[model samples]
Target: MTLTINTDVIRRLRDALLAEAATGAGAQDAHPHRDAALARVAPFAETMYLVMIADGRSAPQEIAAVRGAVRLLTRDLLEDADLDRLLDACAAAASERGAEVMLQVLGGRLCANRGDRETAFTLAAAVALADDEVTDSERALVGDVAEWYGVSSKRARELLGAMQSTG
Candidate 1:
């Protein structure tokens, strides 16, 4: 079965997060200030791009999938120019330092907030599984993201399993 990450999956995960926050089990600061790095769309898109190209091929479908996800994740805040810049940056970084180094830097910037960590993990996994199959490299990179983002393995599995099931 082909996997598509439309609004439904996004809504489901979002609702789950909201429920957790409402119960105070995963409560963050009530008035947490939005960090630019956290609030902006590029950082998250860059991470998803890294996962998309993890299989060593940036197929058009994968690129489109990432773009769609960034739109959803950013709530349409990612302007066209931002998308252009994000692709350029990813290509430059992937060629220069590589996905490993890129993700490492991204993790440092995003790891402070548990909520962002989970969002990044789930979004990366969504991209990885977007094309109806997860290549070995993509799977490994998703695993790496979960570790670097401080998402427990169990939570990672739960997120991926939900995606797979919905797809």
Candidate 2:
């Protein structure tokens, strides 16, 4: 599906990412202020992705665009050293635990909104499948997300199967 992102949503998410990156870099007040600032961004990022996935229009190119825009905004908001730190953090996070952690964060938001857990899991699986191949790492991460949502493996398998069959 062709994903046409909402410019307003993209702009809001971009701004939040930049602000969070800056807060992480000591650009903001010390103490709990930084955490508070970042907390504000978390919901927007999570909700935006949820909306994108639900729309069934999340293409690899669109995902790449969103990631690139976030990175650019982050770099612009933070100093060189801070930007490096943020990038390093992302790399390390992705490497250490794959994308599951990120997915969980987003999942938490969806759960709060009483969203469909099955659909959310399916959407995450679809995101992993966006490249036309579900890598082992991606599959593992999707499984983790499914588990987080209290979805049985059998049910997850069923949902995934249904999505695949329809796609």
Candidate 3:
């Protein structure tokens, strides 16, 4: 027997799935808990994207590492496609509003809690080291992210130390 592929059927199924996902996400505002959680997660995820491209280019390994970190952080609520879409949206915003502006916007969404700020800074610093060697630019961006989130230098050191110990 010969194997047959039906591209049209595959396209239709893909569209259907995308529509369903969109519909579910459209109701996000109807659920305050989910909306709040997403608001927190969005900036964290965007912070990783910003750090990944801090060196003017993003490495595949860095992208993969960010994806893994976000997946683990969100308990895999975001699939690979969802993460890619997020990164795309981030890139668009950075281009449209500029990276500094985007960082300012994202920093505003970290729930205003010290813990969240620290975590964002820590995760962002970790993302900077995703490619094994942190460039000067990436390091600076990490520092900027920490500062943007109001993470004190002492707290930043502690968070980086913990990340280094574990990573």
RMSD of each: 9.2, 10.2, 13.8
**What would the TM-scores of all predictions be?**
0.71, 0.38, 0.71
Model 2, 27-113: lDDT tens per residue?
A: 342333444433433332332243234333455532433243333433334234433344345445545653556667656765554
Cα displacement (angstroms), candidate 3, residue 143, comes to: 0.7
| Cα lDDT computed for each candidate against the true fold | 0.64, 0.44, 0.62
- How does candidate 1 fare on TM-score? 0.71
Q: Which regions of candidate 2 fall more than 4 Å away from where they truly are?
A: 1-114, 162-167
Error of 1 at 116 (Å): 0.7
For model 1, the stretches where C-alpha displacement exceeds 4 angstroms are: 1-39, 162-167
Residue pair clashes in candidate 3: none
Q: Which lDDT value does model 2 have at 147?
A: 67
Model 1: per-residue Cα lDDT over 25-92, one tens digit each: 21133223223423466667778888888888886656666666655654444455555667787788
Top lDDT: which candidate number? Answer: 1
* Candidate 3 segments whose C-alpha is farther than 4 A from its true place: 1-38, 162-167
User: For model 2, what is the alpha-carbon lDDT of residue 104?
Assistant: 71
